[model samples]
Target: GDDDHEGEFGASSGGAFHEGEVAFDEVAQEADDDRDTISLVVVGHVDAGKSTLNGHLLYALGYVDQKVMHRNERDSKVMGKASFAFAWLMDGNSDERERGVTIDVGVNTFATEHRRIQLLDAPGHKDFVPNMISGAAQADAAVLVIDGSTGEFESGFHAGGQTIEHTVLVRSLGVQQLIVAVNKMDNVGYSQERFDEIKKEVGAFVKRAGYRAEDVSFVPVSGFKGENLLERKEEALNKWYCGPTLVELIDRLHPPVRAVDQSMRMVVGDVFKTQGLGLCVAGKLDAGAVRVGDSLVCRPGDVEAVVRSVDKHGKRRRHARAGDSVTLALNGDREELDNVRVGNVLCCPRNPIPMVCSFLAQILTFDIAVPLTIGFQGVMYWQSVNEPVVLNRLLCLVDKQSGEISRKRPRAIGSSSTAIVQVTCQRAVCLERFADYKQLGRFTLREGGSSVAA
Candidate 1:
């Protein structure tokens, strides 16, 4: 049985086919299109008001009109969920509305004074963590929502909390900038003591999770009452907390440098048929640029397709560059369209991505209950792709400080250890070396439904 599963996804030893350069066409520049864009994902435990906070932010920014809010108020009240009125603005699905829990990634776009923000509202429930991973994979930064009510913060921040898991997940996926929004301060009567307690504890954990003190920021706000979001309207909050509002902090986030020189690559998040567009695939461009009439290919199948049009946040554009969440109108027949699935990578046809079944990875183990050993099976999540994988070999443990081999042929790796190990996937999937591509190479490993390593 062990032999049957070895190299199920890719070869035991191999490298990507070629390191060829792709010819990219110059994109037509649009006038005054200089505003930077940032993809932000809101994450935390269930009922932490992630959706409510973001939903109200959109409304306060005038993205949602009064008529819509009034209707949502009436409808949510009828369903005995008046508190979910703001959340309904983000949670569009009927099931999510009725259940009062976000099940899928709710995406919406808004702009600050200096930035165009594509907000991704991630599900907080543990069952939906995989979905959250999908959202975090696309995000350049994260907004970790924390409940400030008594006992709530402890529950979400302690061992086995989604807060801890989310922090690690986002950081492992290459999200550098973090904004910890201490939501529901109204419950604590806007107490400075409570806010400081949360800040101190969360701040320490964030550092341990690989975030610098400078990159991590904290803000106190009431998601339900809508205070300290756009402005610190509450007199109580102003006495002790004289800091930037949530919107202000968001506007201050640094945009990541785009990889315009690399070949075009985008991982498909969603695929659907449109009336006029024929077929469309939505994703954040990971590298290079794409324009109308550009030829592309989807990996694992190597199916060729053409870009019919490019659109960002529903606005038609002639081209889109790296770090943009865009929908590409693709031209293809029925058979070709059927082959394009989520987790499939789209790149320039001249240089298609490689499919790998096995590769060596440098992973950092968390507080896993069981030690990682040879033949250990777990799910590997890379970008939008999740595959069954086996730890085919134990290479060696490396010292974090010295950058030297700690041990050769380590039989087992425990918690908080760094090791280079060979992993085999159940099937071939497209991935690049982390040294070559930071975003494309990083991944998380989950075992027995818990995130064990990254």
Candidate 2:
């Protein structure tokens, strides 16, 4: 059903709606404070020590005190899994602890002398890859944890390894800067030779994934012993590796810039109702700003609600801007806010975001057994929006890399090939042309429940 229809912005055939200007009141501008924050996601293969490394870093930085450490130690020992003492700080969920693995993204905030960090600790298991994607969508940079134990690096980097998939995914999802932490060097005796070997292999692959060599950095450390995480302690191989600790390297990362003055728009990643607070929606604002008493519209639902309050990093504020992860408490009939669910976008009325049923996109398929063609159906994951979609037409096959159209209508687009195609959904959903907004425009296609394209 490729039916053409007209609505708010007229026919949704061509040209994306360009949100012009917005008049954010002075009070709305008061909470317009800039944050020197780095939204960093921690990712790697299962048991790569992602949670251990992040948990220990927070503890070492005084974010987690001795009392919590003692409690975690006693509880881990009782469970006969003492090594999880550090991981307990992040894996607070009972199921994750029972399974001895991280299944959900754990968010925590900590500050360095130079910058504030919003750390997203993502699960590394293949089963939890979708959860990882959710966390990565909110990050500006990523820290890829790799197990340096004997035979472990190869296992995670080989053909069926999560390392390869994760490396490709983060790069494809717009993470330009990546820190490849060669963790658990203690298991390998902190050998510089091993580190060099890993650096050469991973460095080459990440480069092919569109990351510049300079933007991809390597750090050798032992998350278990907390070595080279803060202050570099003299180790057996200190002579060969004298680079700054992980903390120093992170602090040196380029601070992310914000778009606080553009048209107000924020994607709802989670929704809930509090005891005292009304309906609360949480997500990162891609552009513009919002404040208390500000009127906003939720698209697709088209439900209008006023902003009752803004909470940024646990502090209730009068306003908040782009580049921030905030919770907006709505002031209206409780049903209105309750009706607004995750994947719903809140925007300024003046600059209404385009919500459509179908659109054209440039897709790069993965190495799959089957090729893509007309009538292909898959789940489309755009931010928090996960919906089934159909490939209505194979508009044209394009160059694998350059994206130049090569065929008007190919019988099928093979694996690892690129093409511009038209896709339709059963119901209307929000999507913008990739040319307009990278965050809202980009998405991944999954068929048979596996990621098929990006």
Q: Which candidate achieves the best lDDT against the true structure?
A: 1
Error (Å) of candidate 1 at residue 122 is: 0.6
lDDT of 2 by residue, 197-239 (tens): 9999999988877788878889998887898889667567587
Least accurate 10 contiguous residues by lDDT in model 1: 1-10
Model 1 regions lying over 4 Å from their true place = 1-32
- Per-residue lDDT over 77-173 for candidate 1, one digit per residue giving the tens place of the 0 to 100 score: 9999999999999998899998999999999999899999999999999889999998999998999999999999888887567998999889888
TM-score of each: 0.92, 0.90
Q: Candidate 2: RMSD over Cα atoms? A: 6.5
